[model samples]
Target chain A: MTQLSIDQIQAGDELPTLSVDVTPTTVVLGALASRDWRPMHHDKDFAVNRNGTRDIFLNTPNQAAWFERYVTDWTGATGRLGKMQFRMRDSVFPGDTMVIRGKVTNVSTDDSGCAWADLDLAMTVNDKITTSCKARVAVPSGSGDNPWKRRGSDWQPNGPGNSNAKANGS
Target chain B: MIEIPNEVGDWIGQPRYEEDTEFDVERGYIHTTCSSVENGNPLFWDDKVANELTDGPIAPPTMLSVWFRPHHWAPGRKKQAQPLQIHFDLKEKLGLPEAIMTDNTMTFGEPVRPGDRLKTRQILRSVSEPKTTKLGQGRFWEIEVEYTNQRGEMVGIESYTGFGYRRGA
Candidate 1:
């Protein structure tokens, strides 16, 4: 597994532009996995005639999950998500390609061996930003130790302690 | 005219019991067909990278948006009342006004990897009064759902915003 130290990432460092296609099947599977029963996401005619939507757009939860994935993928197991905020701008249809872009805006280290980075994120389809967000992550300071040794190492079971684990060193 | 229910707010936030969600590696791959249709990029298609990010081939980034809702695939779960339709019908019964979709946004979280079972906790976030628009009388509301995996991890949050308008003469 490849891991980058929080220190290695700079304020201007750009996270990879990950892209995914949004399709009816994508929308349906997301809704199914999410238990979202709203018809506009799945119903074409309803969106076109009733909602005046160009096409079914990606839902908010799915967008949030993607943003999380983008950060986690970069931070690996050593980083914890602290806060995230984003706005849905344009509508994304099934056939549109969704691209995620992120830039490291701030980096700091606390008394503990935790490193923090604030990121500016945007998801665009066909050159239009459909979602823009900001997220803060707490990552291990590395303490000059090998990062690969700790891949998926710090993850605790989801509970009161889980949030604590991220807050501890960061 | 539809009669307004005295306790309309009570009905809005009634929590629907969450249902079980399951996923198989193959099923997850099959689910990615939507990504292909959307002209998805190779990042999602690369098996090695996907495994690194999700521990296995995961669904497309937006796969959950369309899949989790109670539908023909999961019949037992569908037995529960549909919230959107119920609200629509109730509004008519109460002679309440119409709603519309003004705008909405979503923030992505961790990748919903393959074989992850998620449970959705639904909530009625808020209902705002009619906002004056040039075309009509528009009212809006935000419906939010927090999705948690079997591990009790907050995988994502979904919020839907809708607006309603008065009929034209």
Candidate 2:
């Protein structure tokens, strides 16, 4: 995978969308792989009687992992996950399609000259957002060096140089 | 109207778990997670591609929760605490037995590599004042899980927010 250079990226640049069929297997496998063996994620009866959901649903950790994958897949090999935060609006149930889409909300270089992409992502189903997220990823400046190899990186979610600092309101 | 409990504040600023966690991060498990999510990124499983980045394949940041899962079923294994005990506790107090996640946030440090043994400590950072929303009557709480490697290096930190509420009064 090619690293996106500073010039190759810009605010509002929409990343390719990913659509996943949220099947019972999809929901259950995601839960088990994450070691989240919660009954709500696997047992339909428990989910219906105990949780009051339509069917066994995906767990929170499973959703968080998917958000990480969505962003990193866009950042390429030279990039590192900076920070990821999101709000869960609705439950992701089996048979729902989890369509993930993201855009470059901001781009900046930290003190060390590492390129960072601030992404705003929404995982939606049935025309409603199930989760909304903001993430930061340090990408290659296309300067031929890995950003993670820098002696130090000041890539905090709301650090001084981060363009989203004020927006993060931290 | 929602009534906030007094003990909810007692948990704030307190360590949630009794002990820390230490275990070797496994590659096979990493692969299982990647495949489960249909994440085919070579960064997670391809050492050849990883050599281009670091020493070897690294676990996906999404696998953060997988490391702490209790054994599926073991005769003598300590019963793991409820995933969201505080939320459940508060819900039971407010007559709201169902709780859901309002959001999740996490910050990663260096990449976690296969074979790297790591430890983690869980802390209850804060709990919100009782509030009423369209969903139900309850509160929101944040839990922070910090990870440290066998080398005593910080691996990553996960901050989670859970909203516990009953559907209606």
Residues B98-126, model 2: lDDT tens digits = 67777777766666778877666667777
True contacts kept of 2: 0.57
DockQ class, candidate 2: acceptable
State the C-alpha lDDT per candidate.
0.57, 0.73
Chain A of candidate 2 gets a TM-score of 0.87
How accurate locally is residue B82 in candidate 2, as Cα lDDT from 0 to 100? 53
Residue A94 lDDT, candidate 1, scale 0-100: 88
Best by TM-score: 2
Which one wins on lDDT? 2
What's the true lDDT of residue B45 in model 2? 68
- Could you give candidate 1's per-residue lDDT for residues A1-170 as a string of tens digits? 24567768889999888888777877766554455656677888876766567777666655666776677677754445655666766667888888899999988764434467889998898878877887877665665542212222242212222343321211
Q: Model 1: how far is A69 from its true place, Å?
A: 5.2
